[model samples]
Target: MLILLLAAPATAQPAPVIYLDQGWSKEDREWYYQVSQGSTALSYDLFLNLEVATGQDLFRSDANSDRYGLITQAANPRNNPDGLPIGLAKTVVTEGRSKGTYVGITCAACHNTQLNFKGKRIRVDGGVGNTFDMMAYVQALDDALQATLADSAKFGRLAGRLKASSPEAKTDLRKRFEREAARVHEYRTRTLASAITWGPARIDAIAMIVNRLTATLTGIPENTSTPLAPTKPPFLWNAPQATWTQWRGVQQDPIQRNLTETMGVFLDVDLQSKSPSEGLFDSNAAISNLQQIENLLTRLAPPQWPEEVFGKIDRKKAEAGKALFISICADCHNAWPYTWTEPNKHGKRFLLVGLVPQSYVGTDKGQFDALRPYAITGQLSDQLPPPLKGEKVIPTDQLYEALQEAVLAKALSKLKLTDAQAADLHGYREFPLPPKPMAVYKAAPRDGVWATPPFLHNGSVPNLYELLLPASERTKKFYVGREFDPVKVGLDTRSGTFLLDTTLRGNSNAGHSFEDGPLGNGVIGPRLSDEQRWAIIEYLKSIPEQAGRVTPFGGPPASPAR
Candidate 1:
C-alpha cells in the first residue's frame, strides 16, 4: 500500500492526527543546522564580483537601509557571536577547491525566524522568516554589480581579486561578468517594470524560478516570470516525512523539489555541452550537496512553541481546546506518525500532510491557480541544448503525469542517465504522478504553525485570529513582515503595511471561512465562533507538548454535500 496517512471517517472533513514529538531526538540538532544552513556558498559566486562588496557591505546600499537584512539580533543566536541578525547566513569559502571561493544566502535566509512576545525574544529554527525581501535583495545585487562594472575603482577591486587566480579562471570570470551584466539588463528592461512588490518574507517562487532557470539563464525570449503571484516562503519543518509537498500537494518527490528550489536560487549550472560522454552541463549544485540537505531535513524537528518566550500555556483552556479540536478541526487538519516500510526499505517516518480540494477547503484560488498545471506547463520549452537534441514539453494539462514521466524523461535524457538508475536514486527524487491537478492545497500540518504568522499560502490573512474570521471580515490590506503582535498572533500589520489589496491579481483572501459547511451554516467550513476559534488556536499552540495523547475526535461526520 502507498504511504498515505488517511484520516478517520468523516463525511466531509477527515481525521488522522499524527503526534510529531515522539520521534524527535536531541542528537539531531547538528543535522538540523546542516540542513537549515544549506550551502553557505552561492551558485554564481564563481562569476559575480561578490568579493568586491562582500558580507554586510553587499547588503548595505542607499536604496534601502537595514543592511538588506544582513544582520539581526535574534534571541537564539546560533553560530553567530556578534549579535548579528537571525538567519543572515552568508560566508566566503576559499579553502581547497578547483573553482575559487563563493558566497550567498543559505536556507536559513528564509526559513529561520525570531518570535518576540511581550519583552521576550526567542529564535525559532524551521520557522517562516520575515526579515529579508528576497526579490529586493536580488535587485539590489544586480544594481550594485552593474555599478561596479561602470566604476573604475570598484572594477579595480574586482580585478585585483581575479588577478591572483589562473588565466582560465580570469577568462571564466570575464565571461560570467558579461553574462551577469546582460541578464541584469534583461531583467530591468524586460521584467522590472512588470514586477510587483513582494515587500518582505514573500516571493512568487515558481515565477522567479522560471525566470532564473529559463528566461535568464537560457536567454530565452518567451520565458517571462510573473512576480504578481507572491506568496510567503514556507517553513521547512518535518518535510521529509510529508507524503505530499508544496502549498498544494503537487510535489511528491522531495529531492526533485529541493533540486528545483536550488536551481531557482541560480546554482551556477552551465548548459553548454562540450562532449556527450562528459554529460549535459556542469553545475556547482552537486548531487551529494543536495543529498546532504535532504538527509539533514529528515532529522529536523519542528519549532515548538517557546514556553520560555511566550510564557506558560493555560492547561485548562488547552485541554478544552484539545477536545474542541477533535470535534471541529480534526477532519481536515489531522496528523499521525506515518512510517513508510515496503517501498522505503529503511524505516523512515514522516508526519503525513493532508491535502484538501479547493471545492471543499475553498480558500484563495490565487495560490492554486499560480501553481496550476498551466502555470508550469506554460514555461516548458520544447528545445534542448547541443548533443541532447530533443523537444522537452509537458504538452498536456496532466501536471503530475508530466512531472513523473515527461519531465523526468527529458531530464534523464539530458543528464545521460537511465530510468532504472534514476529510480534507485531515493524516495526523495522519486515522485508519484497525480491523476490530475485537483486544484487543491495541503491542509498543512499545524506543526510550528504558531510561530509562522501571516497565514494562508499567499500570506494574505495576517494572523491566525484573522484567518478564523469570516472570509468577508478578514483584513483585505495589511502590512506583512512587520513587528510581531504576540497577543494578536501575527505581524503588527494594523498600520504601515504595504496595503496588500486583495482585489489585485493573485491576492484574494476569500474562502476557508469559519462556520460554513454542512455542520455549520457557512460555505467553506463552519463559521467558527470566537470561543471556538480561540480553542483551536490554543490546541495548535499545545501540539508539540501533547505528545502521544490521542484525542478521539470521532465526531458525527458533517454532511458530505459541498
Candidate 2:
C-alpha cells in the first residue's frame, strides 16, 4: 500500500519563494507585510467572509486572481497568520465609527515584487510590483460584492461565517455588506475604471488621490477627473536615502510622501465636516506606522543579482559596459556609491538625484502633465489656506498637496510629538517641505535595476536591451503580469493577462531612445550595437555588488556633455 501510494502521482508543491538580500530580516519582511498605513479597504470579517464572482473563497486561486496577478501567500505565525497576500494588512480602526479590524493595503502591495523564472519564484522586497493589477483587483472586489448581494446562497454563507443566523443579525450583515459594496463600486467607477486600462503595475496615483480628496471626500462631483496618467509605482529601497524622491523629484519630505500614499489607498477621513473641531482635517493616516515604514526603508539595500538562479554575470562584458556607462548613462543615472550628497538629521547623507526635463528625456509626458492642470474644487475651496483660498478653481497638484499637508499637520498635532521626534519621523527633515512644481522626472541610481523590469518612468519599455533600441523599434504593445526574462533582463512579454498598448496616449513607449538620430525627442545618447546593449545590461546586473561609498571625483562626471 505504501509503495502503491508513493507510485501514485503526487500534487505539485508550490515554487519555494527565494528572497533577495534587500536588507530586511525574515521578521522585518513579515512585519512589512502586516503593518498598517491606515488605508481601509474593507472590514476584516467582511474580507474573510467575502466570496469571489464564482462564489469561491476570495483567497482561493482562480481565474480572477491569476488575471490580476495577486500574489498568494502562506500563513505564518510571526505575521499574516490569516494568509493575506503581500501588502495586505488588517488593523483595528482606532478612531472611526466603523471600529473593527479592517483590511488595508500597505506600500508592499505596489512596491514588493515576485518574479517567476523557469518555475522558480524569486521575491524582490521593495522592488516594483510589475504584475499586480490594481484595477482588476478593485473590479474583482466589486464583482464579489455584487454577486453576494444578488445570490441569496452566497449571502447565507457569508452570514453564517459572521454568526448572523437570526433574521435581525442577517439584516444588519446585509446592510454592512451593502455599505462596503457601495464604497467599492463608487471608487471603481470614479477613479479606477478608466478609458485607458491601467494594466498591471501602473496607476494614476496622483489623479486618484486628488479626486478622492476634492471630489469623493468633499462631496464635489465636479472636482473628479478621469485618471489619465498611469505610471508604475516607484521602488522604495533607496527612497529614504534620496534628497528628492518620487518620479517627479517633487517630494523632499518622506513622511509627506507616505501620508499622500496612504490617503490614495483609502485613508478614512472626516474632510467633509464643516467645523474644524468637528474632525474636519482628522484622518486615519497612521503617522506612527508611516514613520516605522520609512525607518525600515532606510536600511533596505537594493537586491543584488542571484548568479545561481539568474546565471553568472560576465565580468569582461561588465567592464566594457562600465566604460559605456561613464560616457553615456552616468549623467542621468548617477555613478554607483553615489558621491554627491546633502545633509540629513539622521547623520546620513542623501543622494542628489538628477532631475531631467520631461522634454529632454521625452518618455511619456502624461505623468508630468497630469499634475499641471487646474480643477474646479467646490466648497473645499473655502477650506484652502491663503492665496488660492477664495478661488473656485486651483491647480490640481497644489490643491492636493495643501489638503494633504493640512491633514498631516493636524494628525501630528494630535500625536504631540516633540520637534526632535518629529524631525526623526520626517526622515530628518525638521519641518515638512511644501511640494513644489517641477517639469522634470527623476533619474535615480539603478543599482539593482536589472531586477526591476518594464523600464522607463511610465514602464513602457520592457527591458534594458529594448530600452537601448530606437523608440520606433521597441515593442508597440506587449503583455505584462507574466514571468521575468533573465536573458533579456525584463518582463516576459510573450505571455501575460494585461496587454500594454504603447500606442495609447499615456501608454506611449516613445522617447528615451539610444539610436543615432536627431539630438532631441529623447535621443539622449549615441546608438549602441546589440553587443553593447547586452554589455550594459551585464554591468547593471553586477551593480548591487559595486554600490556604496565612492569619491565623487573618483567616479564618472554627474552630467552628460550634451
Candidate 3:
C-alpha cells in the first residue's frame, strides 16, 4: 500500500539563528531582478488563446490596449519596453506545428507588485501583489473572447488580422475559434460554481491545481469540484532556502514545485491530436524552461526597504524595534542559519529549516486543511448542473495516490495529460506531491516580510499597522488594489476599491495577535503596545540595510561573518 500521511495540526517550529543583515551579494540582487522581471517557465498563456486548432491568432488587435494587466505596472528594473505588461514575458512556440511567438505571463505576475505612495513609485519585487485580481482576469478573458466572437464586425476584423485566405478558410477559422472559446468558457463555468470568490491578491491555487488534475484534465465522473481555499502566493526572496513551500508546506522539491505551477498556468505539454509535422510533445524544452527559471530564482534576494522613498529610518526607533522583534516575534518569524558546504560545486546547501506548526497559527484554518490526507475536497458540487453532479464522490487524495502508483504513461493517459498525438506532458511530478502529509506551516524566514503585506498566509489583513491591531479593531472588509500608503506602512486602505471580505471561507484574519501572551503559547505571541508593533515594522523595513551585522540569538558569527 502506498504511504500517504494525513498529519494533524502540528506545533510551532523552533527558531533558526538569523543575522540582522542577511548576507546577499550585489550579484544576487541583479540576478533576482532578472528572475523577477523575466522568465515565465513556459507559460500556459491562459490570458491568450494559445490552443486554437488552427495556428491562428484570432485575438483582438487591442489585446493589450489597457497598459496594465490585472494589476498596475511598477518600476521596471531593466526598463525593457516591448509594449507588454510587467512580469509578462514574450516567448515563441519554437518546436510546435502551431508556430507563433507570443507574450506569456510569468511568476512575477503574482509575486511582484508596486506601492505608490505620494506619487513616488516603490517597486517591491518579491512582495505580495495585493492589487491583482486573477479570477476576474480569467472570467474577463472568457467574456471578451466570447463577445469578440459573437460580433460580426469584430470577427471580421479578427479574420482580417489573421489574414484568412478564402471564405471557406474564414469559416473554418470561426468554427475553430468557437470550439476554443467554448473550452475556456466551460472551464470558467465549472470553476465558478464552487461558490468560490477570491478577492484581489488571493486565489485558491491548490484548488486550481487539483481541479485541473481531476476535473479539467481527468474528466472525473463525479465532477466534485475543488474547494476555494485561497491564500496569498508566497514571496520568493527567501524561497530558495525554504524547507518546504506553499502555506501548508505541501511542496518540497523546488523543481517539482515550479513544474506543478507551470501546469497551473496551462503550459501546453501535450497536443490533443498528433501534429505529424510538429511531432508530439516538447518535454525537453518544457523541462529546460523550468530548470532555467529555478536556477535564476536561486540567486533571488528580497527587496530592500526604500529608505529614499519611505525616508531615513529612525535608527533609535528601529534599533528598539529590532529588540522588540527579537523578543516578541522571533520564535515564529526568526530566520534559520544557511550555509553552502566547502567545495560547493558538488556540495549541497544546508539550512536548519524550522517548520511552523499549522494548527497553532491563528490567522486562518481554511488553507491549512487543503492537504488533509483523508479529506475529500474535490467532490462534484451538488450545485453543479444535474448532468455534472450526482455521481459518487471520488476522493481527491486517494485518486491522486492511486495514479501516482501507476505507470507514468498509463497515469498520464488516465489523467488526460497524454493524447493520441502526444504520449505525456512530462510527468516529472504529480499535482499534489505524493502525500507525506505535513500539518504545519513554516515560520517563514522573516527575511522580506516588510514588503509582503496583507500579512499572514491568506492575506486576510492589509498591513502591519492593521495587523498589530487587535482582531476586534481589524477591518472585516476593505478595498485592495490601491497605491501604497508610506505613512501607514501598508497599502492605502482608504483608497482601496476592492473589498476583501474576511468572512469568506479562506480569508479569516483572526489570528497572529501579539498581546497577552509569550513564546510557545499556542496561537498568540508576546503582548506589545502600538509603539512596539511599529518598532518591529521599522526593523523589518530596515532588514536590508543592516547587512553584515552580528547574528541574532547572540552567538559567534557563522561562516567567517560574510
Candidate 4:
C-alpha cells in the first residue's frame, strides 16, 4: 500500500524501493523517523482523520501528495508504526497548554531522500529530501483545516472518525480543532505570506527560527523580519564529524545545531514570559532525544554510489576526471584522505570543512545578509547578558546564539540534569568554537554529494553539468521534484513541480563557474570543456578514494597536526 507520488497508470507495477546501506539498522531507522524533537505540527488524532479540501483523506489526497515532495508512507508495524512518513513523529505534550498526542516534525523530514530512477525508487537515508516543499505542505494543511472547519459535513466526518459524535464531545472536538487550526493558520501566515517561493528543498531556516524566537515568542511584532533567503538543508552523513554545520558554517556543536533546527521546525516554548517564575525560557524541547539523535548521526555514513542499481562507473573517464578535479575543484570541495583535526576528549578527529568567502564564491548573499545586525529592543533584552541587554541593536546571529543557549539551559534545568549530564547532552562540548556570522558558504566533502541535487547553497543550479557551465550560461529557470538524472548527476529539470527562476531574489545561479574568467567572483578556473564536464560528473558518481592525510583548504591549518 506504499504510494509513491510519481505519475503512472493504475495497472502499472509499483516501483521497487532500493534502500542504500547508509549504516542504519531497522531499529535505528525507525527511531530516527519517530523520535520527537518536540516540534508539534498537528494533533495526531486530527492528522489521522483530516481530509483535503476535496474531501479526500489528507494523507492520500493530492494536497498531501508526494508529488509535492513530501513522502507518504503506508502503514508498517516496525519501520513506520504510526504510518507517518519519515520526519513526522508523534509525541505527547508535557508542559504546553496544547497538551496531547501531537504529530510533530523530526530531522528525518528534511534529511531523508528518495530518488526515482526509471521507475525504481532509491532511498538515501541521510541525503537531502529534495522533494519536500515545506511552504506548500504548511499551506495545504492550512487549507485542509480551514475546509474542515467551514464545512459542517467535513467537521462531522472528522468528529466521527475520532468517535466524537455526541453533542458535548463534538463541541470539545471543535474547540480543540479550532485552536490547532488557528495555530496552523498563524504559522502559515508568518512563514508563507510575502515570503520567497521556497518551492522545494530550501528554506530560510535561520530566518524562520529567529522570527519565532524574536517576534512570535516575545510577542514583539516589530522584531519580525520577512524570511528572504532560503537554502537547502545540508545532508547529515558526515555532519557530526565536521568542524561546522549548515550552509553558512555558523554552527559547530551538534546538539546546538539540532536544538536550533527543532526550534525552527516548531518546538513549543514560552520565551515571552517576562520573569523566571512565569516560566520564562521554558520549552518542551526533547533535550535527551536531541542528544540521542546527535549520537546516532555520528554513526551515519554517506551513501556510496550503488553500481548495481545506478549502473557501473566509467573508471577510465573517472581517472581523467580525477586529475581535472584535483587541479580545479580540490581546493574547495576537498579531496579525501581529508585532514581530520580538532580531536575531542575521545580522540575523535573532525574533518575541517572549508568555508569559502561569499564574495569570491559569488552565490546569493541573502543568507549572509539575513544574519546582519538589526534593531531588537524587544522583550529578549531582559534575557540577554549585561552588554547586549541595553543595546538597541543586536546581530541576529549573536541574538540567536544567546537565545539557543538560554532555551537549552532552561530545558536542562527543568530536567534537573547534572553538570556532567548536561555536558554529555551538549556533545561533551567537543565542538566548542562559538558561532559567528561570516560572509562565507561551507564547502562540504563531496562524497555522496552526487546524490544531492539542485546545487549551490540556494539550490539555484539544477545539476553538476550546469554547475560547471559559466554562470551566465546556466539555466535561467528549471523545475524541481523531478526524477534523478544519474548521467548528469543531479535533478532531472525537464519535469517536476516548483519552477525555480534563478533571476528571482535569493535564487541567483550566478556563481561557482568552472569557466575561464577572473579568479574571484566564482570563476575559479579555466573553462571546462564538455568532455571535461562529463568526465567530472562520471568521477563524482565513482566517488574516488581518500588518502590517509591531506592538508585542509578554506579553513585554518589542521589544529597544528593534533
Candidate 5:
C-alpha cells in the first residue's frame, strides 16, 4: 500500500499567539516583528504576481482571462506569425501533438504546494503539492498514449512484433511508435483547430491522444473511470529547511552547480544532456533571466502568522537555540553567511561541509574504479581523447571546457550521443557549497536542527524528532502502492538505521546501520549523548534571520587569490 502523508485538516482562523522569554532582548523582539511583517507582505505579493505571470486564471475574472490569452498566444509557436519558435514555446509546442495548449499548463500542475514548518502543516495553493506523485502523472500520460495507438491494426501488429524482438530492436521500435503518435496527434489537432476557427492548444491535443493511448495500451475505457486528480502547487517557503538528505537539496545543488559552472542562470535540462546547444544558453545572457527570477522571489509575500500565534513561540527556547547554534554548528554549518567551510589537514583544500553525496555508482568504487575510463568521462565520452600517457590525470579546467564544447556540438547535430565510447562515463562530482560569512537572507536556514519534517534530499524523513530516533526505529519499509510495517531498526538507542528495506533505500546506499560509523561500517553520524544531540539541535534553531536582498554573501567578490 502506498503510504502518503495525509494533508492536515483545515482549521478555523485563530489569533496568532506569541511566546516571549527573558532570553529575547527587546531589540531582537522588534527585529523579529519587522521581519515577520515584511516576509508576510512579500510572500502574498509574490504569489499574486506569479499567478499573473503564469496566466493562472485563479480568480476567473475577465481581465485575468484576457491577460492569460494574450500571454498564451505570445508564448505559443502555433500562433506566432514568425516561423521561428521563441523561448521555450517552440520546443514544447512543436515536439508534442498539442500545438502549444499543453505548454500553457500552470506550474501548479506539478508542484503541489502543502509543506510543514516547525511542527505545523501549512498548505499553499497552486503548486504540485506532492513531489512523489508527480512521476505518476508522467506514467499516466504515457499509458494513455499507448492505448490510443494500439487500436490501429497496423500499429498493434508493429508493437507486438517489436516487443517479441531483441531489446535493442524493441527500444528502436518504441521511439518509432512515439514519433508516429506525435504525427497522428498533430494532424488531428490541426483538423480540429481549422474546424473550430480558434486553434486548439497542443495540450488539448496531447490529452486526447493520451486518453486514446491509455485505452489502447491497458484495454481500459477512457470514459469509464474518473479523470486523474489535479496536483497542488508546491510551497517554496523555508525551502532552506529541507534536511541534508532530501532530494530538494540534491535538486538545488545542481542548480547551484549550473550557476557556478555556467556562471549564471540556466534552464532545466534532461539528464541525457540532449539539446546541448539550447542548454548552454550563455550564462552572461542569463543574468537578466536570473534577475527576473530573483526579483519575483524577493517580492514574494511572507507567510502570515497571527500576532497571537507569533506570541506563542517560546522566546527562551529560540534564544537558547541561537546561542547553541553559534557554539556548535558555526564551525562547519556557518550561520551568518549561511554557507559551510572547513579546512583540510593541509588547509589547501577547504572542504565545504553539508554536501550530500552525489548519486553516481563508480565514485564509490575504491581507488581502482576511480581510474577507470568510464569514471571520468562525464559528458564527453564520444569525443573524449584517449588516455594521456604517463599521467592519467585530466586537468579539471580542461574537462570542464570539453564537456561544454561537447554539449554544444551535440546540440548542433541533434544527436543524443556522439559515439559508443561515451558510455563509459559514470561518477558523481562534488558540488562546492555556496561561499560563507554572507548575510542571512530569506533562504532556508542551515542551523542544523530546528527545521522539521521532510528531511533529506527528497524530503523523505518527516521531522527532526524522527531524525533523532535511533536507526532501527527509523527504517520503515513501504512500497508505492502497497503498505508495509514501519521498520524498527532501534535507532532511538543507536546512531543509525540498517538498510533492511531495499526499495526505500536509493542506489549506492548499501551498508550497515547509520549509527555504526567511524570504521566505515554505518550510515549515520558518530553516536552522541541525547543531551549533546539536542543541544546541537537547539543551536541549529538559533540562526539569525536576514531581511535584506540576496546577493553573493561571502568569499572574495573578485577573482580568487592565487
Candidate 6:
C-alpha cells in the first residue's frame, strides 16, 4: 500500500498541511479569492468612473451609454434648442464624462510582449513596440464624434420643442448650445493637432486652455473643478510623489504652486497666503477634495506580472553594474533603500535630490503673480473703477483702499486694466544637492531603471548606456549614439550632434546640455569607459522591482491594459 501510494498519480490526495488556526486557515483561501475578485471588480468600476469623470467617451460611441441621456438628450425637444445641444454643458452636467478619453489609449496599444518557451518574458521597447500615437487616435475619435453630433434633423426637433416652451429662453438656449457645440468641435481639432505636433510643452498649454474654457462655462474655479472635466486615463504607475502625504521629503514649494495654480486649490490652507478669516475662497472644500484624491491614489497597485512570464537577471553583470552605479551614478542619481534625515525638520527624508536652477523659474513667476492682484489692487478680485489718467494718485494710506476697490471692481468687471498681468512666475523650488556628482538630474524614482526606458524628465535619453557618457562627450554639438538621436533632442541634424550648443553656453534653450555649474555642478567621479558604461547599464537592468502601493477602495487602480 505504501509503495502504491508513493507511485500514485500527482493528483492523489496531498499530505495534510498544518495551520496556525484551523478554522481561520480553512476560510482564508476563500477570503483571498473573494478579495482578488473584489479587487478586479473595483478596478473595473474605477475605470468606468474615471472614464465618465474624464469625458473619454466623447469620441467612442460604443463605450458611451444612451441611458444617461447625454448626446441623445440633445436630440430631444425638451432639452435642446437651436437645433443643437451644448456639448460641454451636457458633458459637465452629465455624470462620468472624460474630457480627454481618446488620449488615454492602452499600454497594449504600444508595448507588445510575448511569453517565451521557458515561461520567460521577451518585450520590445523600441518605437516599433512602444509606439503610442495619441495624436492619430485623437483625430480619428474627433472625426467620429463630430459626425455623430452633426445630425441636423435630431437637433432641429430638439430646438423646436425648446421654442415651443418659451421663445426668449429658446433663443438663448439654442445659441448657447450651438456655441458650445462649435467650441467642442474646435477644441477636439486644435487639441489633436497640438498633441501631434508638440510634445511635453503642449500638455501644459492644452491643460491651461481646458482650465480656462471649463471655468468660463461652469462658473467653477479651474484648479479644483477642472479635474472633474473629462481627462485621458493617466498611467497608474508613479503617482506623483507630491501626491502622497507619506512621501513628504519629495514635497517642494512648486508642488504647492501646482496645487494652487494648476490643481486650483491648496491642499493645506496654512500653506496659502490667505488667512482663514478671509473668506475669499472655501479652502475647506478644496482640502477635502484633495484628501479624497489622495486617499484614492493611495490604493493604486503596480501592474501585475502576466502569467508564465518571469524575468532573469545576470547576477555577475548586476553586481558589476552596482559597483559602476555607486561610483559613477550614485551622486545625483540616488539609488534605492534611500533614507536621510531632513536638515530643517527633524523628520526622516527619503528620495531628496538637488534642485536645478531652471526649474525654479516657473514657481517664482507664480508667486509674483499671486501678489499681483493684491499688490496692484489690494484685494483678491477687482471691484473698483480704474483711476483716471489725470486723477491725483491716492496717498499711501488711501492707496491700500484704492487697490481693494480695484480688486473688487476687477472681479465685477467694473474696472478695466491698462496693462497685461505681471509676468513674474517663479520656477520650481531647490532641494539639497547630493554629496557627489550624479549622471542625471530631475529623474524621479521609478520601478527598475532598466525596465523603464526613455530615461530623464522629458524622456530625452532612451537607455542607460547613452546616459553614462560624460557631459563633455555627450554634450558635443552633433554627437549621436544608439538611442540618443539629435533630432529627438529637439535639434535639427545641421545643429550638430550636441542637442544643446554647450559651446555657445549660458541658457541657449536649444537642448539640455549646458555647463553643469549651478544645476549640474559637483564632481563625484571621473568619466566612464565604454565597457564600464555598458556594465553600469547592465547593473541598472538588474535591480529588483519594488512593490507599488495598491489603489484604494474609491480610487481603484486603472486596468492593466488601458
Which number leads on TM-score? 2
TM-score per candidate: 0.73, 0.92, 0.73, 0.91, 0.40, 0.43
By lDDT, the best candidate is 2
Residue-level error in angstroms, candidate 1, position 474: 0.9
- Estimate the lDDT of model 5: 0.28
In the order shown, the candidates' Cα RMSDs to the true structure are 10.2, 5.0, 11.9, 4.3, 17.5, 16.3
Indicate the worst ten consecutive residues by lDDT in candidate 4.
Answer: 546-555
List model 2 lDDT by residue over 401-464, tens digit each.
7888889888888888887787787777534454555678898988888878888878888888
Model 2 scores a C-alpha lDDT of 0.78
358-389 per-residue lDDT for model 1 (tens digits)? 76666666654443233232323323333223
TM-score of 5: 0.40
**Candidate 6 wrong stretches, greater than 4 Å:** 1-58, 61-179, 183-196, 199-202, 205-289, 296-310, 343-350, 358-441, 469-527, 545-562
lDDT agreement with native, every candidate: 0.53, 0.78, 0.53, 0.76, 0.28, 0.29
Q: In model 6, what lDDT does residue 394 have? A: 27
User: Per-residue lDDT for 367 in model 5?
Assistant: 12
Clashing pairs in 2: none
Clashing pairs counted in every model: 25, 0, 8, 6, 99, 65
**lDDT at 7, model 5:** 29
Candidate 5's residue-wise lDDT over 165-241, tens digit each?
66676567557556644533432332112211111010122212222222221123321111221111223322322
Output the worst ten-in-a-row residue range by lDDT, candidate 3: 13-22
Model 1, TM vs. native: 0.73
Q: Which candidate, 2 or 3, has the higher lDDT?
A: 2
Model 3 C-alpha lDDT versus the unseen true structure = 0.53
